[model samples]
Target: MTIDAKTPEEYISKVPEDRKEAISKLRETIKTNLPYGFEECINYGMIGYVVPHSLYPDGYHCDPKQPLPFACIASQKNFVALYHSGVYADPKIHDWFVAEYPKYVKTKLDMGKSCIRFKNIQTIPYELIGELCRKMTAQEWINLYEQNIKKS
Candidate 1:
């Protein structure tokens, strides 16, 4: 599902009707728990939370024009996905989320480097996602990205 949306609200409006509520809730959860300094916008065609350029002028190493992305939520064709850069960059957070997942959802965890796919939207663990959002602040993400992701 490629949604050509200029804003987060537009993205949400374009998602499948069945997924609107879940995506909205997921967006809300991320927004409510994400630490201060992260701004919400449409990034990479998804609802993205990023560290604004004002905070990190260098921006994303891959694309200096864009802000430093922290997290994103999107409704895909088969599932709704949550992408958290911290989980991919930090082993401790990855291990913690992996161990804690079974406690929340019965379905087997569907995850990639940073993408967590929820095939059953009803099974999406909003609370755990919120906690994950709160795990890293913007400055911390900038530090981690510099050390682990950004190339010299």
Candidate 2:
């Protein structure tokens, strides 16, 4: 889905009302632990947490004009997803999340490498999600990305 909203509030407002609370809670949890320098905006049709252009002048490696993506919350057709760049870039972080999740959430994790899909909003482990969101800063992400590129 193409995100037409220009601002985070506008994006949030456009979300299905049934999902507003869960998305809002997820947004808030992310914000609470998000390090300074990352900004929340509407990106790729979702509420995206990003490393603003001001901080990373080059922007995303794939698209220099666009800000680097860090994380995001999206209301998809079938589920709500929380996308975390940290987990995608760092295997240790992904492992930590996988090992820690079962302790906090009873439902099986519906996750890919980076996207955690919540088929049922009530199944989300809010605290664990917040901590995962808190795990990296913009600089840390940039460093990790650079390291990966170098290894490539």
Candidate 3:
């Protein structure tokens, strides 16, 4: 589904009322942990925190102007998703998350290439989540994600 959100406020407005608080809280958490140079914006139907294409002029992930670095927080019909760049390349972190997350959440965590679909804010392991946020930079994440793409 294409979420036509022009601003973050608009994006939050689109989310169901029950999910808004959790989404907002997660948004705060992500914003607090992001490294320097990353910016939050609306992209591809979700709340995408990105490294603007303008900042990395040489190209994104080795291709000039090709891709941007992003961490997304998305609201779905049934749950919210936290899309972070760390998941694709860091086996240790991925393993930690997979193992520990279920303990905190009531519902299952759904995953995609780099997306973590979760039910609500209460399910998050704040410390580990914060660590994941602090560990990745736009360039580092872009490199890792690119490697995964190549491997796949």
Candidate 4:
């Protein structure tokens, strides 16, 4: 969780032993459902999927040297988190998730603008999560990100 990891394996390995299974399982789900053209790697100290520099030369708006981030999974001290940039950047996406979550999940949702926190792995809705991961292609995300940035 320290953002010191240089690789996905390293990032996962650094998670506390008790949280490893949940972390790995969630990671697997994300990887399996993630859209194409987005590359996986360690970014900002978490296991991140990014739009590679070759695809987006502008990089991250805040840090041009880095690839534009799409999503990330991390095990924090109190909870495991899934960060999807799309849900925050696009209102329609955010609304879709919010509206659809209750239909798929029985437990109360614990989420922020871009992160969904899970304290209990059993309560996590893997199917809905995967759908969110696959909702848009890499190019679609780029356009959405750019549109949001311009509006800002």
Highest TM-score: which candidate? 1
Off by over 4 Å in 4: 150-152
C-alpha-based local distance difference test score of model 1 = 0.93
lDDT of 3: 0.73
**Whole-model lDDT per candidate:** 0.93, 0.87, 0.73, 0.87
Q: How many clashes in each candidate?
A: 0, 1, 3, 1
Better of 1 and 2 by TM-score: 1
Error of 1 at 105 (Å): 0.4
Clashing pairs in 3: 59-63, 59-64, 59-65
Q: Write the per-residue lDDT of candidate 3 for residues 51-88, one digit (tens) a residue.
A: 77666554444454443756788887666788776775
TM-score of each: 0.98, 0.94, 0.78, 0.92
Model 2 lDDT vs. the true structure? 0.87
lDDT of 1 by residue, 1-152 (tens): 66899999999889999999999999999999999999999999999999999999999988999999989999888999999999999999999999999999998999999999999999989999989888999989999999989989
Query: Mind giving the per-residue lDDT tens digits that candidate 4 earns over 1-152?
Result: 56578888887778988888887888888889988889999888888999999999989988889999999999887888999998988888899999999997777888998998998877778888888998888999999888876334
Worst 10 residues of 1 by lDDT: 1-10
> Which tens-of-lDDT digit does each residue in 61-130 have in candidate 2?
8887889888989989889999998999899999999999999988888899889999898877899988
Off by over 4 Å in 2: 149-152
